[model samples]
Target: MTVDPEYASALADGLTIPHYVWGKQVDPLGEIDNITYILLAKDQEEMRLRLLGSATQTMSIILVIVIFVSSTLSTAWRVFRQPRSVVNWCTFVQSSSATMAFGFGITMKLSTACNCRWAIWTASLGQAISGICASIVLVWKAYLAYDRDRRFVWAGIILNLPEPLYLYAAWMHSRTTFTPLGGCTMLYPSWLPWARFGMDGPFNVIFSAAFIVVAARQYRKHGSAVWGSLRNEGTIGLLILTFSNIFCLLLTATNFADEYSMMFWGVDWLITNQILIHQHRPMRRSLHESGRARGRNRNARRHDAETLFHPQPMSPSDKFAQWAELNLLQPKSNSPLASVLEAPEPDISDIGHTPAPNTASHLHSTQASTGYW
Candidate 1:
């Protein structure tokens, strides 16, 4: 075996060199075969990792694309078929952000056409957008559930604001590099996991807790009716999201790879936006309708019960006039009979009058004496 002078010098100095590069050392005997095998094995492993990453990314992208198409079509259909309403614009933003994040990521991973910087930056921006928009939608839901109380809304906004800010700062310091097998690898600081955790963990806990509390209150107030209202709002979806967030937070807290933890990222975005887009409208409408129904019932109760019942038998004048018309007189204008019939009855309630017990008899006696009846 013949060793190159530089290789001998590097080995003597205890400097480490890549096996592939070190393989270039002159070896007239068959000693280079071992280095070649090592390099080949390393290449194989790299290729396998690249292939696995590509396959997973492709699957995530396909899932997100399907969800995006369906959600877009559904939202469009709703926009056209329904009247203008309190539709949350965040729903649209959520869908777009998820699609963009996954789409850009998959595109950058699969193809080498675009600059990596652009692709990675766009994907990062999309992720930030999705997270922020999702937070907004959650706070809005809590707002609606709590009777549109601005105090909680403001508190939620304040609490959630830090996640995106920290995310932005972390992303600024983050870096990525292309692997030997044509895959991108995220290079981040040790605190990257904490950043990811902060992006979703605590705020999700608060929002999900708020929702669950509201649901409990509704169940208490309305019993089974809460099911009817929450069916439209997808209470189960909220639980799913809460659990998913908790799972993601655990993954991050345990120092799992960001890439592995992100498998559900796009799917989470889809569900978040889908809940807001389809379920929220019905929930809001149900709340508004229920409110209006209560108002109507309250107003209905204020009406005088006597007015709702049939008027007291009939006034003596009305009975007598009817009998006279049937038996003798045809109603004629400018006649005394016509004047009697046309005269407006004084409203007892307005005049503060209480009729006597013999009021009907007394009225009949007076009319008979006056020859009016």
Candidate 2:
């Protein structure tokens, strides 16, 4: 009657929980030199939850990659459109956030003893760098917005500092944990699988809170609309930042990393555009203004009609008809977006559809009909 070492060890350790136990091959020298393998039993109940978490993590990674590439390109594209402003800097901040949440978040997220120590170092450093970048750029957006509102700018103070310190601090912390493919994180020395819990967890909580607070405080007057810029652009940054922080908190709290890793990936992927695109206002506006300037207006605007019909101008009727079209189609200056709205389709009786009386017929008839052409 031989005692099994696996059960015997667990019993000796006073352990009762179930776990995955790996058994080994036993040789013929059973009595004197037996080389039997053993494994610790795993809890069956945790199987499904942990599996789901793993799937979620996979998806989260895919999304992060998408975000990284897309964001990089988006900023690049903006470079061509708005060469004057450092818009890419602001856009890159959003990109960095998406990268950190799924990239480093997952690494610290999977900080098990089995994970290589080197990975923890790199991921942690990467996140720290990303965070530093994000914070600076976020602050930059506020600065730019305020600059736009108030013409004065403090160029000297703004340009000479901050990033160097950010880069140096991130590098120093990262040296503690950097290994292949694995991201960096603090080395925790705890049994419950949350050794670096104190170091990493607290920062996320604090930063998230600060991000939301700053965004809220700065935009209090504008409510994300920023008055001059598009409404969507004003609030998109805050929304993305808020969502990232909230997800980070949730992941930490529920051990989702331990259970639904893939779900996190999905979230990371979605955020890339949400966060960065807010900075694409210049692009969006450029398109709108150009379209307006170019004759996209359905009225068939004769913007260059004066030049076209130079010396011998056409009859006043021809001019009136053309002008009528422009006046009718000219986008409302007060609201550039008013055209997108569906105007109450002109009822036959309500007027716009009524044919314009020929100018020669009667001035009163033309005026009374509210004619365009």
Candidate 3:
């Protein structure tokens, strides 16, 4: 007589059992023994959970791809319409790298779905590359916001120069194995996973924190005007990156890589969208100044018109002269001058006053004087 390995394994684990002889109750020493039905049910339930988790990861990857595509198009359109700047070029690089990262992540997820041996290798390599790109973005933003020393930027760049070699090492050391749930999963030496996480995770946290602190300090020192050039979208995106990294660290520490791999894609999506939106919108102060100038011009025009058409009461001499002309300067109806004298004297009380300066020109001068433009 033979027993299923699964049944034997279950029994070895001390799961409850029943003894019987041809459907009749028997002593504890009965030759027929079986694992409880509850054990089989539990195994089925575990499989269901795994399937649900996979489905969730797939949906998340799809959504991330959609967001990446839309944001890339938006950024490209904005770049085409607007004059380029250093910041714009940096934004383009960051967005391009993020899009590549998302693409690789999608590929890794698809490979995993197919239960390919390469899935783990691809996932490891893709995530490493993506992490490197994300780090570059954060470092660049930090340089823009706080670091004055160009050497620091160069140093940071040099630090990441070996990422390709590191990734190659990770791939070379990884091995493929069969797994009941994921199938053909790639397994890294225990030290390798921790080493990768150790290098990437702490740096991610530190960089994110540094970015927030630097931005906040700048905001406090210069007020919101500093952000006029930086854009709120970049600040908000940094915040999102910070929190997402914290979450990713937590998930990785808890050994939930498969359950939360989608977070990597999400971070890239956030970065791409932030760059796109920030580039599309103009600076806030410029918009405000333009509106204010228009308002001032309108008010000036109104005041000038009132002064012209509704001059203050005429002086007594002016009034007397006007009355004398109307009553004493009578002329024969046939005279050519009669038409000129008979016509009501044109009101010229305000004509002597200088014409109001051009309101638009005045406002423009004021803007220049105040540096509002």
Candidate 4:
């Protein structure tokens, strides 16, 4: 029952050790309880490794495909329904590329026909396109937020040019072999397994950093109130892109398994797309409302100015009075006869002359006689 040390070591290292019986090469692991047959520790470990690798790959493939498909559909729907902006178009491109890449990846994982030479080529191409689109999206947003120059955008495109070439080269150079547990397992180059990350990582990080700086500057210059309204629309998408790229880079740097790393990347992209879609709606609504408010304010100011300069028309009675005054048809009465008929007014000359000495004596005698009794 003792296993050979060399066989144990090879098995531990995930190597398939050949079974031998009676000094002849034999499939002893296939036989049961035969005295001439023997199973070594390496065989058991190899089996376990294959099983684990297969399970991991299957799970990863499923997860990536589901996430990519759902995200792609959602993004496509948004792009179709909503007005297209630079950001929207970028999102659409990223989503579409991701969908194709992951879809092809799933086919490769599931189909035996994927062993053909063209499979890897197509897979590499799809992934490269997806990555370039994503990088462009991030850079585009940054440029729009800060630089907004066509030259800068073109420069970004130029910078991303090498990614696809590198991806194809890396994929072509990668080691692909058939395994019993997994149909075809591709072992990429140790130095550059993911060409997308290798080529676009620096650019993605730099542009993301630039976006953060530009967003911060905008927030400071415009104040929190103004920036707060724009946070979801402008800053959040950049933040998501930055963090997702950082996560992918960290996973790659730490030498995490490629299956898990790729799955994580897909999930991150799906979440980013969802966030962008969610943020887009509110941004559009806010913009629409602001435009309406501005229009209403303009109309109100115009109405106020018009009312201030031009008086309102008079009512019917007021118009009649105005017309009468203009035609000199109004009544005027200040004649003495009219005043005497209304109420007589005593004259100052009469008051001074009427009270003569005779009048005064006769008035006094009459008053005394009337009151005598």
Question: How close is every model to the real structure, measured as TM-score?
Answer: 0.57, 0.38, 0.46, 0.53
List the global CA lDDT of all models: 0.57, 0.42, 0.51, 0.55
Predicted candidate 1 versus true structure: per-residue lDDT over 137-239, tens digit per residue:
7777677677767987788678766666655543565544333332344444666656665667677667756866766666566664744566535657667
lDDT of 4 by residue, 120-159 (tens): 4455566566666666666665666553557658778888
- The full ranking of all candidates by TM-score, starting with the best, is 1, 4, 3, 2
Tens-digit lDDT track for model 3 on 138-180?
5655554453446547756766665676466545654343223
| Candidate 3 local Cα displacement, residue 241, angstroms | 3.0
Q: Relative to the unseen true structure, what is the C-alpha lDDT of residue 96 in candidate 3, on a scale of 0 to 100? A: 59
Which sequence of candidate numbers ranks them by lDDT, best first?
Answer: 1, 4, 3, 2
The CA lDDT at 170 in model 2 is 30
What total of clashing residue pairs does each candidate reach?
Answer: 0, 35, 0, 0
- The clash tally of candidate 2 reads 35
Give the backbone clash total of model 1. Answer: 0
* Model 4 whole-model lDDT (C-alpha atoms): 0.55
Candidate 4 accuracy as TM-score: 0.53
Q: Candidate 3: worst 10 consecutive residues by lDDT?
A: 28-37
What's model 2's overall lDDT?
Answer: 0.42
Error of 2 at 357 (Å): 45
